[model samples]
Target chain A: MILAATPGTATLLVELGVILVGLALLGRVAARFGLPSIPLYLVAGLVVGEGGVVELVTARTFIESGAQIGVILLLLLLGLEYTGEELTDALRDHAPAGGVDLALNFTPGLLLGLVLGWDVRAALLLGGITYISSSGIIAKLLADLGNTGNRETPVVLAILVAEDLFMALYLPLMAGLLIGGDALDIGLEVTAAIVAVVTALGLAVRYGDRISQVVFVRSDENLILSLLGLALLVAGIAEHLQASAAVGAFLVGIALNGPAEHAARTVLSPLRDLFAAMFFAFFGLQINPTDLPPVLAIAVALALVTAATKLATGWWSARQVGIDPPGRLRAGATLIARGEFSIVIAGIAVAEGIEDDIGPLAAAYVLILAVGGPLIARAVEPLTRRFSQLGRPARPRRTPTARGTTVS
Target chain B: MTEINETKLPGVGTLHDFESQSGGRIGVIAHHADRREVVIYDSADPDRVSEGVTLTAEEARTLADLLGGTSVTKRLDDLRQEISGLAIDWLPISSNSPYVGKTIGETELRTRTGVSVVALVRGDQPLPAPGPDDELRAGDTAVVVGTAEGIDAATELLTARAR
Candidate 1:
């Protein structure tokens, strides 16, 4: 065998290997620093991207397709874990607050985008993308801060779920507009999605165990293959219907949610992790450093404004719901991270070849969110505690118990 | 004074009364005194000390005397060990079942199923282990922990469809 065959293939392999290893190590480092690993992985991608050491993943259609798969899988898993009852409860409890938060963040983002001389559609897309709260990062931070057991976790989780649902609808709506798709086409796609979801739910109820036993109980390898096939099949169907593939994957996840599904997850987790890592890495690779400097300043300002708006919105709504000040702060802080959806909107604008000038600015905004999301989340607990103390009257403290006693 | 072989029954305990003593490995007497005589023990291999002849209390005491007082202690230990390793099985709720969309507390699952809900999985996420307030969704999978009888009850309740 030839030691090194094709130069193009060799270079691609080396770059891919190096980027993955570097990102993995950097991810560990980020965790050690008490930061979310997503940003670090993104940073690793940037380092190995065009302007950095080696460019492995080019800004090509195929790479975008792969990244899309990653997003679909991520959302699909999200859907799988979601129960309609819990989600409905969450929406009912937080809808007013969520709506208010949406308005507060989106209005300012829209005005800013307009002022910046961006296209109307671009402005709206940007507004929607920026207005979203980072549920993943916030949830992770809450767990890290040992406040997952707090009363606020559920409320905040609900809010995030509501926000995600909003984004799920909004992202496609924006994409449809940008891609020149008609309202009737969009409606048909949405209807198809609903029908597919309902069908999956019906099937799950009727034959979940038999299907799981037959598909997953055979062998570990077979289980992995079946789950992957299912994810891909659902995603493909969604794409064919002109609906977001992520939505289909999520529906599949929802359908499969149960005891047998748990077994399936454990086996599929490694595959999901690997693909997710690639997804983020691809995001990092797409950032063009030459266009970043001017965009960075504007992006940072927009991110701060969005974060502050969300914090205020989350806090006020939470307070209205009778949540304690500290809990509200925690919720507000956790809502700061944003990811793929925002970038996807920006990517659509770029792909349509309209408002190409703002593409760099949108990328910069994503980068800032990537960095700032974790910082805000990390600070939420300490900040909440400080604020809580300030609001409280001085009183004699009870001696603490080792196992932890509930506060009255 | 009596000499006992302590090495034969390692770490065995002595009984204060002779009636309570076990001649060999002590076993749970499963049947009535008049029926087929059998004892349940942890050991795969049990030693026999008697022939076809009926055993008197004195004869039993004499057999115990030969085996040493340690046999009784060893038998108790073995019985405890066997009971501890008993397995519990759990089944998932079928989608069309009435148990779906109900809370564990509302179901009176503990009383009916004899099995306690230890954990639940809905999709990819497991519920923060499970608690009373956590409602059971249609697709949720519950991990029930209990004895065989308890598990049997739980399975029946979980798999039962809406009336």
Candidate 2:
């Protein structure tokens, strides 16, 4: 009966179906290779996007927004991993390491931006893009590699939480700096964003348990719809307030606890999986494949330099926690991947007409690392063990044995 | 060996489809909080759930323990401590309790109750050999090694208000 509708509607349905089917096939292929599906999804988007083999005639707008939702969901899920108190504890314990992370990993891109002779604002944008790690990619990598319980993981996560805290601050400041004129306007915008973030976080910490109870319903459908609606509403409000929508979603996550948190995670995973793939693909869609080739060399060079810096940050952070050398290396290797946030930064820059080359450059850089990071993380374990054997004895060794027998 | 495939059900559980050695596919949906559902699938169409049953958290743990061994579940393992004379229990430090932000030593658990704080599970990280100075954060599960009477005393000591 629905097929009896207009040709335009039919076309829309057909395209959506085709894209989802394509993504599923690519995901299966990614499984075969034992690599992350993100790279494959990106390639799929490249093939189907503008300038690729088949340029889609319709549904770009819908896919684009879905991609935004994907980013919000990614950050939200990451926040659900810990309580506000734990985050606060981590902030206190790992503040110095977080500083180390920002200095080492963030400096390269800032320098590169200056070298490229972009404005101070653009350089800062690039630096922000480079500084934050992709929580989504790291989560997938941990699950795939079965490295969740590794001794270095807590250190890695601590660093990530610190990064998230920084991101909440940096994103608003960047947006303000990018948009406003003069010092006072910039200060006002940044201060307002920070206040909004703090208020949201405080409210979440205080009333989260109550909010979670109110949201949960006996029926599965109601619970899913309610959580989704709540996330969107909060994200929309945060966006309007000139803060990060993702930070808003993340706060919502931090507010929920115990059974509700687990329930939400279970309910949200499928939607997250679907939207997140599109988010990756949508990023690829924005890039011109032809433009990427020229910037490819520079992008790879940036990735190589930053990868090492990220590894250094990880190694330093993990070593500070007294994890053995091998675990330290693994920590460093895992942080190498950069995904959605970098692309988001580049997308904003392109939208604001900050710099023309950055969009393509960021695309190439992300592509290189998103694929390379996991590969290096997986390959590093044996290599590190071998090298550690050659070197002097380090701290007491801790081996990762999975804590529980999970059927799924 | 049990062959398992899974479909994650939103707000409900992860429905794991296990292929039995008899070539039958049975499904078990492990709920996030405290419930696990078992459903029989049709032999012809493994996707079609034929019959269903549900178990509470304790019931599920007991079932797993019965089928496998004592160490089948983490909570159960914590319940049935491997220590010979030293009984262990992962006592949750309740929120709003006075012990929420004090250290093991400050709580004076060992001195007052002769209980050794063996480990502390904060979120998922198990800090084995938690030191005297390790600050007890909210929601921490303190693994205490002591006799039954000593454990009751230690629990009282930790939750007791400052004099």
lDDT of 1: 0.62
Candidate lDDT values, in order: 0.62, 0.78
lDDT of 1 by residue, B11-123 (tens): 01111111123433332111111212122221211111111222454555565678796777545322311146343443556788777878889889887756688788777
Q: Tens-digit lDDT track for model 1 on A1-408?
A: 676668766765666667667778987887788776666666666666668666655333444566777777677666555544445556776788778878887887688879988878878877877877655566566546544434444556666676766755665555456555577876665565556555665565456556556655657777777887888997787667656576667656655645546666677666666667777766666666576787778888888888888778767776775777777776677777776666556656665666755666766776677668777766655666566657667445567866766767
RMSD for each model, in Å, please?
20.6, 14.2
lDDT per residue as tens, model 2, B80-163: 354666677777777756877777788887878899999998999999999999989877888888887898787776656555
10 residues in a row with least lDDT, candidate 1 chain B: B6-15
Q: What's the count of clashing pairs in each model shown? A: 6, 0
Docking class of 2: incorrect
Two-chain DockQ for each candidate model: 0.01, 0.04
Clashing pairs in 2: none
Q: State each candidate's chain A TM-score.
A: 0.85, 0.91
Candidate 2 interface RMSD after superposing interface residues: 16.5
Model 2 ranges off by over 4 Å: A1-3, A388-408, B1-163
